[model samples]
Target: MVENRARGNTANAARPGSDAGVLVVGLGRFGASLAATLDELGRDVLAVERDPDLIQTWSGRLPLVEADATNADALVQLGAKDFPIAVVGVGTSLEASVLITANLVDLGTPLIWAKAISAEHGRILQRIGAHHVVYPEHDAGARVAHLVSGRMLDFIELEDGFTIVKMRPPQETHGFTVGESHIRKKYGVTVIGVKPPGQPFEYATESTRIDAEDTLILSGDTVLLEKFARRP
Candidate 1:
């Protein structure tokens, strides 16, 4: 049985490929969190979940349907193809994840974001037309590894080893302007911005002085950035 709680509000109100709304499949931890965040951002989201209990749990919180996304018919009935963006958060089971992603592709969903438990699973999702494949657990673990070092305040790995990090200015950088330090020439990392203690963040310039109490935002190859952060 398929149950749609968005009958009146979203049934025909949103146009296909419109940015006004999104279609989210599954109600697991990731799915639920995505839906809630989208809601908080003021975006209309239609969440689809197979379990009746999960549906009931999120009933008043979000507009959702009780249907198995692995079934293409259920997605069609829920108007999945009408949304410009669709997210498949069924990563617990590889088979189910693949089926849901494939179904979204068959429905011609414009953009698909699917979660994968492993690299192989992500590759399969990509081959099946998922626009973005995310490995949440792997990414979280990697992010934690960087933060645990105590030197890196935050880290964001973009692609192909390129990364951005927020950290304290190393001792060598303190008490000197960016031009005098020649950090990029010596360490291959560019200090993009700096936030002095109790002051607003400002873009880094050759004249910008680095103080010991300031936090620096730098971008470079991950390996080089780590080496620079380790400076005594």
Candidate 2:
């Protein structure tokens, strides 16, 4: 948490404007990373932090403002109302997070993304006008568990309980045609595509052959996908 202090540039001087500009509130891990990455992508970024020390430290690398983001007046003075998107990066402090988010909402910020500490926090953030609520810790934990299980080569979580996984075709399914394998019937997963070790990707179809060395792209319910992953 940034202590209340004014140190870095806080002037509302003429600022640059582009469709790529991003407003990041809070100089914590998520906010800092997002700001840096966006800057690397050639986008203009305005990062805010209450801590004078943090503002001083990071200002050399990017545009930063030292202010209490929970203060609506401060946000307005910082010219946050014009930002196309604002990300509230303080997830641990529910009060600070909510206040900052609400301030952005009231400022008519078009898109607000908030980090949430829990399910309840996520719900509240969404209800309070957060366009997107991210649970980084929970999602990272799920990814780690999948990696440790060694069933999937990669995983991408989609909306709700669905997921996309890349894995070698199970031994039992090798040499069988996609339709013959009956994966959807047995595992409740769909094989969207496949690729050989050194070959280009090909769409999976009823006649596509499933080889042991073929990497399959499957998508379905998270539970069912994990079940399939454990098979081979």
Model 2 residue runs over 4 Å out of place are 1-20
Tens-digit lDDT track of model 2 for 119-218: 8888888778777788877888888788678568888887678888888788999999999999999989999998988999999999999888899999
Q: State the lDDT at 48 in candidate 2.
A: 92
TM-score of each: 0.88, 0.80
Residue 89 of model 2 has an lDDT of 93
lDDT of each: 0.86, 0.83
Residues 1-232, candidate 1: write the lDDT tens digits: 0112234533444344434678888899999999998988888899999899999999999989899989998888888877888988999899999999999989877667898888888888877877778888898888988877758999999877899999998898889999999999999999999999999999999999999999999999999998888888
Off by over 4 Å in 1: 1-20
Worst 10 residues of 1 by lDDT: 1-10
**Cα lDDT of model 1 overall?**
0.86
Scored by TM-score, the top model is 1
- How many pairs collide in each candidate, listed in order? 0, 0
